[model samples]
Target: MAPNDTQVSFALAEPPVETAPAPAEQLRTRFGTLTIKPAHKLEMPRGPFGFSDYTQFALADVPNQPASQFRILQSLEDTEVSFIVLPTAADNEWIGTADFEAACASYCFDPTTSGLLLIATMRRDTNGQVKATVNLKAPIVLDTANQLARQVVFTSDAYTIRHPLEL
Candidate 1:
């Protein structure tokens, strides 16, 4: 999914006496408390590759790192279930290729408007240094217009599940 660059504003208005107070919109996560808005919520029909049980998620910006390339795909079903993702630009070399377009098309996604996010995994090396890698083979494709998403797997060998990050 793409990084949320737009700021959402809520109007300050008192509720009518006849209506009850709205349910809390705040979601407490490992990252912190996030204001759960409809705009930021995503519905995964098939969920991720292995986590089909939990289909609902929220695309949240990394707390205290607005300029960072990473985003959090927080599972609404389970507060502890979350994944770090990297949004791929439309002009990205691999994403702009015909193969990538075909992959997206097979899943009924429009390459031009669909947003792609690579799942990131981090590990510690022998030297006690941390390294990060992204799964290029399997990416979460987001239908931004409908707030729907699905994890698509590319059959081509060009992509790797553990594409190392520069860090």
Candidate 2:
């Protein structure tokens, strides 16, 4: 049959069985009804400073228009607590700054790294008007390989501990 034909049928293929093994369990967390996949988990090596007690967190997808927002779901025993996730700057201009870029480079995070700078939102404001701030000085830097992470503190006075999320 021609490529345009939708009625073409071929039955020579053996029953498809385990052609691709399941993805590694990357983001395993007992949050919500579903157990999140491993890829979604952000590796917190020392865990969050204040939240050192609970290390593993699931960064789940946030449902809404404007795709920037996400849910940083934390597991608290049988209960799951989720925080809104937002970037420090709406635009990545600050990343180009010498100090910021240098800090990232020291951690071997080049421009090609799939690094995500996320801040846990305090409230779930559907209106999206709530003040979204990021911990600039102490940012969570994750090493995509081996799922390792560390919260590094940048001494640059250029940034702030809480910077307003501007569009």
Candidate 3:
């Protein structure tokens, strides 16, 4: 056989490797349960708001009922103080600030696939009527595929920390 023929035969003889997919990440929280991936956790550089000392977190699944839907969840050491997440869908006319893009850029998270946005919150009253707001001005931008994250602030005046969900 010619040299080229031998190379071709060798290439055809090798079989492809088969592997099983990795298991999903599941974390238990005080508010609820969350099914996430190890790559989905975004550690805050300086930590988040009051939980600056707490770095570890897990994104929990929100079972959207007859009311609003939750897109993500944030777990802290307390577990009882997890934050509910919401997506900034275009239909909601949610516009990000200019700094938002820069924050993602710092982490090298592409805007295309890393377009997912998340917000967190806390409840002040037991009735769930009194609720504090999250910082929408600086939202946590996460790249789900890579499990990378960063807090990005929008320079635009459109987004604010007090943008009520009612609107």
lDDT of 2 by residue, 22-139 (tens): 4533333433343444555555545666666566655444433324343444443323444444423212544435654565577665423424355544444678756556666776
lDDT of 2 at 33: 41
Best by lDDT: 1
- Residue 118 of model 1 has an lDDT of 81
Candidate 3 global lDDT? 0.53
lDDT score of residue 2 within candidate 2: 13
CA lDDT, every model vs. true structure:
0.74, 0.48, 0.53
- Ordered list by lDDT, greatest first: 1, 3, 2
Tens digit per residue, CA lDDT, model 3, 89-155: 2112355434545666788866544543446464556775755454567776765545555666676
Model 3 lDDT-worst window of ten: 6-15
**Which sections of candidate 3 miss by over 4 Å?**
1-18, 22-26, 37-39, 63-68, 76-78, 89-92, 97-99, 120-134
**How much does each candidate deviate from the true structure in C-alpha RMSD?**
6.5, 11.9, 14.8
Question: Candidate 3 — number of clashing residue pairs?
Answer: 4
lDDT (Cα, 0-100) at 62 in candidate 2: 45
Q: Model 3 residue 102 lDDT?
A: 66
Question: Worst ten-residue run, lDDT, model 2?
Answer: 5-14
